[model samples]
Target chain A: MTAASDAPQVRIDGLQYCNWSREIFREMRQGGLTAVHATVGYHEGFRETVRHLVDWRTRFRDNEDLILLARDSGDIERARATNRTAIFLGLQNPMPIEDDIGLIEMLFDLGIRFMQLTYNNQSLLGCGWMEKEDSGVTRMGREAIAEMNRLGMIIDLSHAGERTALEAISLSQRPVVISHANPRWLCDSNRNVSRTVLQALRQQQGLLGLSLYPLHLPNGSDTTLRQFGEMAAEAAQIMGAEHLGIGSDLCQGQPDSVVRWMREGRWTRQAQAAASFPPQPSWFGSNLDFPKVSEGLRSAGFGEAETSFVLGAAWHRFITVSLPSAV
Target chain B: MTAASDAPQVRIDGLQYCNWSREIFREMRQGGLTAVHATVGYHEGFRETVRHLVDWRTRFRDNEDLILLARDSGDIERARATNRTAIFLGLQNPMPIEDDIGLIEMLFDLGIRFMQLTYNNQSLLGCGWMEKEDSGVTRMGREAIAEMNRLGMIIDLSHAGERTALEAISLSQRPVVISHANPRWLCDSNRNVSRTVLQALRQQQGLLGLSLYPLHLPNGSDTTLRQFGEMAAEAAQIMGAEHLGIGSDLCQGQPDSVVRWMREGRWTRQAQAAASFPPQPSWFGSNLDFPKVSEGLRSAGFGEAETSFVLGAAWHRFITVSLPSAV
Candidate 1:
């Protein structure tokens, strides 16, 4: 019980955040989320790249009451000290960094803790999880790994292609993160990481976050938060407790525009990449209004301890070990 | 004929763009734009705020056979040098700089020429075009003005609120760009500029770009491209030739995800801000791409020279003088 208040329920990896608005924070609070592994970069668009970290730092520095900017192990203690949730700034697509090696460290300097290699399609690092053909991580991908390792930035392979992700797992000196993903073996979805990859993720000492996209589930739109948690539980069964987290990818408070942008129908460039991947079904609504994930975990018969671990503790350990206090 | 080949035509004021692949370049080509002032930022969500610029510079350097990155007035020559369209990298949201005034120069060092104050809602500078109530410019906004002025980055007031924009124009030594905006007096759109402000813009020697958003027209989606052009022509009449430029505001070829992310409705905190703006009646597809701006100008009986000037020459003049050469 004492520990339950101290850390995130599960790791809660791969929270697909867009902008850090007060509205989003309100949604998080109302949804009953204390913390999230936030994606700072884009599934599409610009200006949000490195800016995500800056805003978090500003929020952390300016308002120490509700949010904590976690850079070191101490920040977690500080989070518990203030009852503020921790935000691990994640780059969903390396396209934010473009091709610069130096920026990896600079971003870490600005408090970017987690970095996803790709999302949905191709980036300089490698093909995305959704790509029809994942040729594996590219030469740039290898370099990115070295740069990330040096910068104390965690290499998150959440939205990465299978071959590329495998190569990245093998290449990365530090443990990586599949921050927001599902098990392909349980119910095959290109967006989900394969069981073999999940196994590799576990073996590599990395973490696998079960995502909450309806398309990734067997029943999809009808899938409840409990089913969503089950997907994580299945992956946990395969990857083990230490390596599993749940990424809500909760865009609940986001507008239809945000959903449209993700859907790739006709709203944004996501449309351009649709040819390379299967179109996501326009599911029920934006991120299941927050607490549903916890309800799902509870309904899934997850204990408070398990839910706590699943909710946030998983990310706490993952980030602590993945991104050291060196920065 | 010479002017037609050399002038900056259709000076697009605003489009929330990110680090695009070659596919975007092809789209621009298909759009038939002779010159484009595009943006680089995380308005959606990607990574590397400044690295986005470096990536494009490299792409332009390698693909000089096709694209050109314009910095200062010279790159326009270079674009003309290789018969490629000149690209002025604009920062849509100052979020890319992350409280660093110096980074403005660093980005300018990498070929950033234009900078917008904010995106949709608010930033350090003040309220965005979409904020219900404007906060005017902030103290930091003052510092930004000096930095941008010192660096010769033209102040873009497209997404800025009325008070902040007027303040920005007044505070700056040079003329700012209200790039890709319509006249609010004409259609009462949030994204559109007011007619009273237009008078002030002329007095301040600022450039006013006629934006193209169907929602900002008097007619709904039923409005034709010709109607959109007429609005521009009307703004041009008010602002005069030297102060006029073609700001296409084309969201075409963008992703559905981008559209989703921007609109604040149903799922988002700020989605329905523009709901009252009234979209124009549906057109017969889009007979108006960027090239249509030129053709529209011609059909309106604008002389070939003036048409060319409206397309590119006006933008060239605005940018050439707006930015400092040595700073």
Candidate 2:
């Protein structure tokens, strides 16, 4: 067994869309997290998305000691040195870009580092996981991919369909990422990726952020820490150790309404009955449970170097390579 | 000689980015223009573009008797029957769509019909006329074209570079258009379409709206009505009479700042020394000059059928095919 001193020093959550507050910021600091890819927009348009940014600006100003905006990898390093959690802004859907391709630059200028092409339905760029048919990357989707690649924005394919995710991986000049999802071979769901996608991601030197969302796990809410850790080890075996990282899709403090809003945006009128606030497993309840995951990784036989990589260094390497040097 | 009765009954200026007002609306009525493609955005982003739309909504409500928003070709027919000029909203640049391709559907819902891939500089979609090197239509530009085609939004390539314009014409599933530009064979500026681009446009059944902007005219401010008409006749011979029309590029009542705004958006920091507003040619000034252009077309020996087509019918046919039937 690894000694207590062999524990990961820098922990980074590859993806989290929490209802952020001072309480959550304190939790992150307590959890010893160096940085987090925090989602800012799901189905929000440009104006609404801007409002979210403004809110973040206010949060940064208010919680200067606890959190700072992470625009690039350098900021993540600064956060580590200062003992603050670096919050990197991301968008789960490309709605903020609207139909104008030029807005990609504008959003990049505003400090958005990652953007997904689709959420759970068909977008102008490509098919979502929830779409009836996967048509692959559309003509506009191809253009958006090029622009995103040119601007150094990480293309997140968490909620995309299999064909779209594969095409995006192939089309991007830079390394793309599945910011939050597991392999469908582990748990059968449209939201999870296939083995083909995982193989493609591994081949392309991209990253697969293992999700801890209850619905995405093999045993759902009953999943144990050992099972989750074993799954990670299995994923690492397939995707290689360097490509695996944790992106706990933890919705800390969010209500049922927010879940409904996320599942059914302005695109739909019907209430999504199945997408109610999911009961998170007791072993992994919140940000404070991050250390328990590290413990589980050690139990799964990940060495000191591998545990450190899966905890944070892998994500740090990814941001260093994926993000632009300047904001 | 064609009689006075042979005068164009349905005059439609294919492109204009006028400083729109009640006075301009009255002038459009005086000019006997049945419809116009009025540019709403040049360099504005999504929020600013929405503000412009709001302003137009107010203008339409205030001047209900003089003008109406043209959502489709049917609106144009209704405008002609009602004796009100139909104002079809267009974007001189695709900045309004920002980076979200899904906004294309939203903007279409809001009544935007025509959109240019670029204005006077490099955009996410394609290179503009002023770029040092034209790399052709970008990947995002290709997807944008496909989306525009699927949504029935007319792809306008007025200010795009030669290679970009040619590529757009070839790549578009539907017929594209150069909403305001002269043939470079007649005018030796980069702002004008090259003979190769014009030939491709003609072959692909695309329309070229002849620009009357002084800088685009062969003799600049000294260009005579006869010279302009003769140039049109020469162009008609090359592009065929059916594909030729008048966009005019009339900038009536706009301030010099608006001109500067068009030439230099947020993309550049250096002041545009040569982008100062040029003097309008005396022979062709504002909306009132429509009648004189018709007389010149007659003087150039065009038949009544050809004159009518050049004035409006061609644009009418193009819009009828390019816009969705519902709106």
Highest DockQ: which candidate? 2
Candidate 2 local lDDT, B1-327, one digit each (tens): 575455438788999988888998998999899899999989888788866776787799799999999988889878977889999999999997788676665577567899999998888999999989999999889899998999899999999998899999999999989989998888898999888988999888899899889989989988888888888898898787778889999888888888888877777787787676678889777787787887777888888888888888888888888788861
Native interface contact recovery, model 2: 0.06
Candidate 1 residue-wise lDDT, B20-121, digit = tens: 557556656555444677766535222355456446656776766666766666666556545566677777777766676655655665566788888777
By lDDT, the best candidate is 2
What lDDT score belongs to each candidate, Candidate 1 first? 0.66, 0.87
RMSD of 2: 19.9
CA-based DockQ, model 1: 0.02
Q: Score the docking of each candidate (DockQ).
A: 0.02, 0.03
Error of 1 at A14 (Å): 44
Model 1 segments more than 4 A misplaced: A1-327, B1-23, B30-32, B42-47, B54-62, B263-288, B325-327
- Looking at model 1, residue A321 earns an lDDT score of 73
Stretches of model 2 off by over 4 angstroms after superposition: A1-8, B1-46, B49-327
Instruction: Report residue A172 deviation for candidate 2 (angstroms).
Output: 0.7
Model 1 chain A weakest lDDT span, ten residues long: A273-282
